[model samples]
Target: MKLARRLQAIKPSATLALNARAKALAASGKDVVVLAAGEPDFDTPEFVKQAAIEALRTGFTKYTATAGMPELREAVCRKLEKDNGLKYAPEQVVVTAGGKQSLYNCFQALLDEGDEVIIFAPYWVSYPDMVHLAGGTPVIVPTREEDGYAPDPAAIKKALTPRTRAIILNSPANPTGAVYSRATLEGIADAVRGHDCFIVTDDMYEKLLYTGEPFLNLGNVAPDLVPRLLVSNGLSKSYAMTGWRLGYAAGPKALISGMQLVQDQSTSNASSITQKAALAALNGPTDTITAMVNEYRERRDLFVAGLNAIPGIRCRLPEGAFYAMADVRGLLGKTYKGKPLTDSLQLSEALLNDFLVAAVPGDPFGAPGYIRMSFVTSREVLQKGLTRLRDFVAALG
Candidate 1:
């Protein structure tokens, strides 16, 4: 059996790979503290779970419309209007397996061979692979830690070429947790407004903010670009519904229809019960989300403080999301139990093997001297993990 060239070009998700390795280690009786996977540690809220249970009991097991159930689409529209300040007709929204599929649909529907998509580093690991799978080129624009890892509009403009077709924006970003300010988003929006390009905003973490900064939904911030903008979101992160496999998006009717056609040919629709649960999640009381955010905020503060207290580690206080990307360059070339720490991967392995702490290496995110630690665990686990990290680094010195 032979695989297609495109299929062969794809790489496994580094986060999941690390997580699997950590889990295997733990199963072997070695205690492992995993901070690599991105899913929230909380259980899915009771209301959302109950909705799915009710759907199952009611025999709501039939196929839904490829675009989504009308009620769910309407609920999504209401969510956009209420939370994102964007009004969308139900026809313009489509729910898929998850935000990953929504984004894959966008790339599949929009890109042609040789089209270029600008992705900022340290981007989510799947973006470039998805672009390649869609026959598009991924042009990576690197941002610095000193800049809060925010991509400058000017730099993005400089990277644009005649073949540039799209730009991806992920705020409360993965791996780095760098939230774009309203001004920054506006500048980028303004830069690409008249250009013959589309913008795909991944607002998966829109509700996970901690810094009290107003989230500027790019689609709402620049309505003129709505026809070309695709906003992808899901229930995985905020609602702690990773196993539900529900995600959605709103865009121009034409694009949504194209995506619907793709979904019809491919996934057909998200799970019927999952859609019901997602509908409940969107329409039910949002107080659980508020409570989760509050707890995450406290955890973020505690984790950031702990990371900063360690020698040779400098972590930026993340503005949103649940990650702490700490620069470990100060520890490079230092010896850890007679083994030299060379880069992020080596540091990660040393931490896991020596201190039983597991984190994802930044090399996968295009930054090699940093490591991403998720703070979505309990305060007790966070404190112990930080203590292990501190002791490990101190031993290195």
Candidate 2:
């Protein structure tokens, strides 16, 4: 059997791999607390589910346009105007399977062989892989934990080379939960104004912010870059619609047309009923989102403080998103249950095997001394998991 070299080189998603292991353990009657998955633990709001049911009952199962149903596109445009203060026409948007596909569409439409995309670490695990799949090189700029994992504009400028085609931005980021400041976003936008590179902003967590700080959309901040800026978002995170598999992007009409063509050949369109559900999500009441964010904020505070209380674990206070990436270097050289703990991956596996707690290693996200713990579960589960983690690390002494 033969396979493409590009496909051969790509690695499976680390998050999903860890999740499968956790599921295996759970199947064996082990009480596993999984902190590796990225989706919110909340259920889809009732109204959205009802909308999907109604759509199916009303025979909305037929295929719409390749781009999307016009009504949904209009709803998405209205959402942009209502939330981000940006204006877009239906032609500028392309609906896809999920936020992941929206990103893939951008890569497929814009990237050529040897093109370089600048990504900040610790980034979402999928960015670099997607770039590789599209035959582009991913140039990673390492950002420090002390800097909230926000990329330095100067560093981005230094990473630029003749082959650079775009820069990827993920705010309220995965793994680290680092939200870029408005000033930093403006600086990056300004730095790339004259350059010939596109700016792809993943704002999937835009509505998941817990901090009082304002989220400045790059397109809104620098309308001059609208032609080159691509904003990707979806109902998965903010609206607890992960299983619905619906995402959309807004950009220039030409680039969006390219994405539409790619979708036409690949996915064709998102699930028709899911599209109707997403329409209700976008245009319906947003109170569920606000309530979810508030609950996550409380969990974040509780979990971060609890993790820090554990000796040898130091977790930074995350401003947005639901993850707390704790630096575990203090426990690296110690022994846990008579086994030597060496790196983040080893520590994560040990926690899962010994403490029945599953977390994601930091190495996959460009850091090697930390582990990401998600607080998407209930408060009781978070407390119990923290206790188990604390006891396990304390045993190292």
Candidate 3:
């Protein structure tokens, strides 16, 4: 059976695949220490869950507007205004299945065939594939690990071309938790000044910041870019509502309408009950998120320290999010058992199969010499994973 040609250009999410493999091994009683998760281990706040329960009791199970529940869209607006210092009307917002969908809709709405989207290295795995699926090419600009994986403004300018349609920025980024600072954002704003490309900001991990500084996106530092910025965020990471399938984006009314149209023909409204729960999440107290961030900070310090202590691994203390992108380049050229540890993929496989530890390789993230480990699990689990990783490195010859 012939499949869509688009499938040829993409692969399944590396993190999800590793996570599933780990779960399967655990199901088989292998005692696999799964550390590839992108979601928080914390359960959804009870108040948010109660909101969904109430919605079910009140028979709010029907389909909502193709865009989303009007109230929920309004709540999204409130979130943007209060949190991001960016104001938007409900007409300028569209809620989709997840932040991923919100971004997919943006690309589908904005990109023409042969268009290009600038993405930084150590980026979210889905960005390039999503761009490919939308008939847009992904222009990867590699960031230095020493720079905290922050995108360089001059490098971005050098990558832009007549075909460049948009630039995607994920602050408190995935895989690598590099939060773009206000200065960094302003530099990017300066670099893209003459360009006609839109800036897509995925703020999925905005609430998971470990930095002592405040969260800032390109929109916040450069209000002029707000018109062209598509701010995508969701309840998944911040509110621990991964299964809720509710995410939203706000931009120009026309772009929002175009994204809404794209969504209308696809998975229409994000789940109806999830919309209610999202409403509660957006308007509810953020104490739960604060608690989660605090716990993640402790785990981050511990796990990163553990990785750095290993003979050949060096890990940076991430500024935000829950991942540690460890440079295993020093460990390369060695053999695990008899197999050569050639790259991150091979290293990841060796760790998972031989050491019963699962971590996402950085090769899929455009960083071949590194591996990404999530500190999203409990401290005990993190310690166990670290122990296994140490033993794996020690066994490599």
Candidate 4:
């Protein structure tokens, strides 16, 4: 059967592929330790879960407006204003199935054929594919680790062309765990403010920051460009409600409306119960954020330090997020178990099959010679995983 050609542009998620491989191995009675998860290991807060139960008991399971429930949208507005310093009306918000959907809706609504979208390398695996699926070309601008993964404004300017339609900014970024400082965000904002394009800020991991500073959104730092910015976030990461599939976006009324119309035709209004639960999560005690952030900070330190201690692996200390991107280039170009470990993909396969450790390789993320490991697991599990990783390196020679 012939499939739509658009589907051909979108690459299958590498994170999901490795995670599923690990799960399959474990299912087949192999002891696999998976560090590939993008979701938090923590369960949703009890209060949030109780809110969903209450909604169910009240028989509030009907289809909501294609955008979302009124209360949920208003709650999102409040959360944005309070946390991000980005003010918006409830009408400017659109809730969707998940943060992934919110981003997809934006791309579908805005991108024209051959439009260009700028992305950072070592980006989240989905950003490039989402742009391609929307018929837009992904222009990836690689960031240097020496600069702590902060993208340079000069480099961004060089990548811009008249075809540039938008840029996707992921702070406390995936794979690299790099947080874009307010100064850095403003620099890029200033660089592109005159462009006839938009910026889609993915702030999904904002609340998981381990840095000793408050989270900063690009929209908040550069208020002048707010009219052209779309802020996308979800209940999944911050609230530990990934399975609930609730996410939202806020932007200019026109863009939000366009996204809503796209949703109206696709999957209208994320699950009704999930919206209610998300509302509870936004309004309930944010003390949960502090607790979870604290635990993740501990795990991040342990994993980064352990990786750095290994003879061949070099790791960067992430200021925010629960991931550690380790430079495994030293282990490449060598033989592992009589097989050539020429690249990250082959290195990852060796790690999983021979060493029982699973990780997402860097090639799919546009940064070869590296591997991304989530410290989202507990300290005990993280210790064991790091030990296995270290031992695997030691035995590689």
Report backbone clashes per prediction.
0, 0, 0, 0
Report residue 59 deviation for candidate 2 (angstroms): 1.3
Per-model TM-score versus the true fold: 0.97, 0.98, 0.98, 0.98
Compared with the true structure, model 4 gives a TM-score of: 0.98
lDDT per residue as tens, model 4, 1-397: 9999989877789999999999999999987888999999999999999999999999999999999999999999999999989999999999999999999999999999999999999799999999898899999999999998889899899999999999989998998999998889988998898788999999999998877888998877788889999999998999988889999999999999999999999898899999889999999998887899999998888889889999889999988878889999999977787776899999888889888899989999988999999988888888889889878887876
TM-score of candidate 1 to 2 decimals: 0.97
Candidate 1 or 4, higher lDDT? 4
Please give, for residues 290-378, the per-residue lDDT of candidate 3 as tens digits.
Answer: 89999999999999999999999999888998889999999999987887878999988888888999888999998899899988898
Candidate 3 ranges with C-alpha deviation above 4 Å: none
Worst 10 residues of 2 by lDDT: 212-221
Those runs of model 2 whose alpha carbons end farther than 4 Å from true positions after fitting are 337-339
In the predicted model 2, the residue pairs found to clash are none
The sequence of per-residue lDDT tens digits that candidate 1 reaches over residues 35-112 is: 887989999999998999999999999999998999999999998888888889999999999999999999898889
Give the per-residue lDDT digits (tens) of candidate 2, residues 37-62.
Answer: 89899999999999999999999999
Could you tell me how far off, in angstroms, the CA of residue 356 lies in candidate 1 after the best superposition? Answer: 1.1
Off by more than 4 A, model 4 = none
